[model samples]
Target: MTTEQSWWRRNRWPVLALAVLLPGTVILTTSSEWFDYQNGLYSHAVTVPDGQSAVYGGAEFRVDDTVLVRGGTEGGDELELDPDMDLIVAVLEVTPGKDLVDSCNLTISATSPAHPEKRTWNANVDLPRKFPPTGDSQTTCSDSQGEPYRLVVAATVPSGAAETSSWVQIEKIGLTPNYLELELSPSAVSSASTSSDISSSSTSAVRRDDLRQKSNATASRLTRTGSTIRSITNPIG
Candidate 1:
């Protein structure tokens, strides 16, 4: 080959490499990302119901409780939340305390989007009159969709109890949400490979030859994300 031809041959790959790399670097750096992580919600002032057979050791009320329900399920057929991933986290919280004085059972759970069922977790008051009521509880759950949750803390007390009393005041509490994340598959969102999962040199050059199209596809994904959020807020049949 002539000297000019030899020079071009030696520099050709490097020149093409720069061409491929510069734009890719720009695209990747500007590319938006969505990652999954954990989040929590806290409860408002919580109160048990009144007039059951198991009041308190003496008083007919419960102490204010601050509950932190993190993302999931401790057991059983978990509530199918994520129709896509079907992911769920069991949640439970309680400050240490002694057993109740009267033997009464309770159920707590969120009653609405703004209200969670508190009756899902409960215990008997106490027996033979113990001092300072105490009980611990937990549950498997998904976060609310950002709203108020009226926690129904219903106590089921045995009727005609000789000594122990039932019935306490009920209270509505706080609610929270978990970070719901989503990623589309090839079929769900067909486009150029955004990134090679592998960094090996072997497949590095296999990026889509159509740069303009890849860019358009990337931006369209954000729209898809918005659509997903809307669906989650109001799902279709």
Candidate 2:
């Protein structure tokens, strides 16, 4: 046989093994993702109406309020934002069940025509703007202290973003992928005129104490219209 034929003959077994193993490795690596996609965990959401409560990850959750802050505070250091940006805050009432609340997470996500894919932001704890004192409220699920607690979550959005629709999603822990989606009612609040509108004592409950501790370098002053809020990243595109 020629040199080419001899080489092919010598390597035939190894080539056959590689061909089989390559496809097998790919399938094995992608099986979990494929299963999640097929089960609708990646694309499905059960929309929950506003002011309504639902059980998720062994915890009861309800979006108590939503606010869209526009202006800045009167005195002290103020955070300036891009003209196209605005602040959005959501208050969630959480009552943990047998499961530890720490295992679950809450997030605010929005969908707009400009970006069909969902844009998600965490409950930011390091933003400069201070909200009102959230008497007895917990900023995180883990700090619930086995009692019903309020979760104050805030995120900055593009100006007039998600006017059509936005939601508060509770991340899945040990539960099914069918997660809860609570609709947000974004009402305007100005810290300049009636700063207490977004205060923790009001219906729109939020706290700036813990966040102040985390981001002392930023603005401690709460503005009337808005603040230079945190930018949103990590789109679930």
Candidate 3:
């Protein structure tokens, strides 16, 4: 009857088709996420205790220990942190699964009630040896005799950042995601505090020298073993 009515009449079929398709498209696009959630894939965080191993995506990961250092060396080079920053290093033991992990990624953050600002940093991963070891030592990822590799991940953050928070979060890289919220045990916290106190006291110079020597020795060993050290970008919060 009118121009508006004429236009609607002409577009009616297309409008109906869109209405019918939109809901179906949404359902189709969201089905996989819903299915994964229902199957427990998107559920609870897997909390692996310190010094224990957890398997994810067929790979075995173990958090062996953690240390607080002023800074450290990697690949025969000194890696010094900023004056206000402290380095937290973790020792990880990894055994590859089906895939040969070329690199590992992680994030470390410090929370403090007084500060209220989060201090977070990405880890710089250092592998102990060349992967897929050459010669007779070579073994498949699944082999029982597979040689486990050690990795040192260092995170540099504000000096007192970790003292306020008891948990440090770690996320493994890749599609099949894995998370580790490592508990900063009392002993670990105490150790960090003790180190901090030593740095602030008159004996700081001596402590720093000692740490430098230790770091150099560590770097020498890693350099000789053909270890690989790579720094990864920080994760988007």
- Could you give candidate 1's per-residue lDDT for residues 59-98 as a string of tens digits? 1222211111111211111221121211111111112113
Question: Could you arrange the candidates by lDDT from highest to lowest?
Answer: 2, 3, 1
Each model's lDDT comes to 0.23, 0.55, 0.46
Q: Once model 2 is optimally superposed onto the true structure by TM-score, how far is the C-alpha of residue 172 displaced, in angstroms? A: 3.7
Q: Quote the positional error of residue 143 for candidate 3 in Å.
A: 12
User: Lowest-lDDT window of 10 residues in candidate 1?
Assistant: 68-77
Tens digits of per-residue lDDT for model 2, 24-48: 9999999988987756553457676
For model 3, the superposed segments whose C-alpha errors exceed 4 Å read 1-44, 70-79, 115-119, 125-146, 165-177, 181-186, 197-237
Predicted structure with the largest TM-score when compared to the true one: 2
Runs with alpha carbons beyond 4 Å of true place in candidate 1: 1-57, 72-101, 114-237
Instruction: Give the top-scoring candidate (lDDT).
Output: 2
lDDT of model 3, residue 86: 60
Per-prediction TM-score: 0.17, 0.57, 0.48
Candidate 2 stretches greater than 4 Å from native: 1-33, 36-43, 71-82, 129-135, 186-237
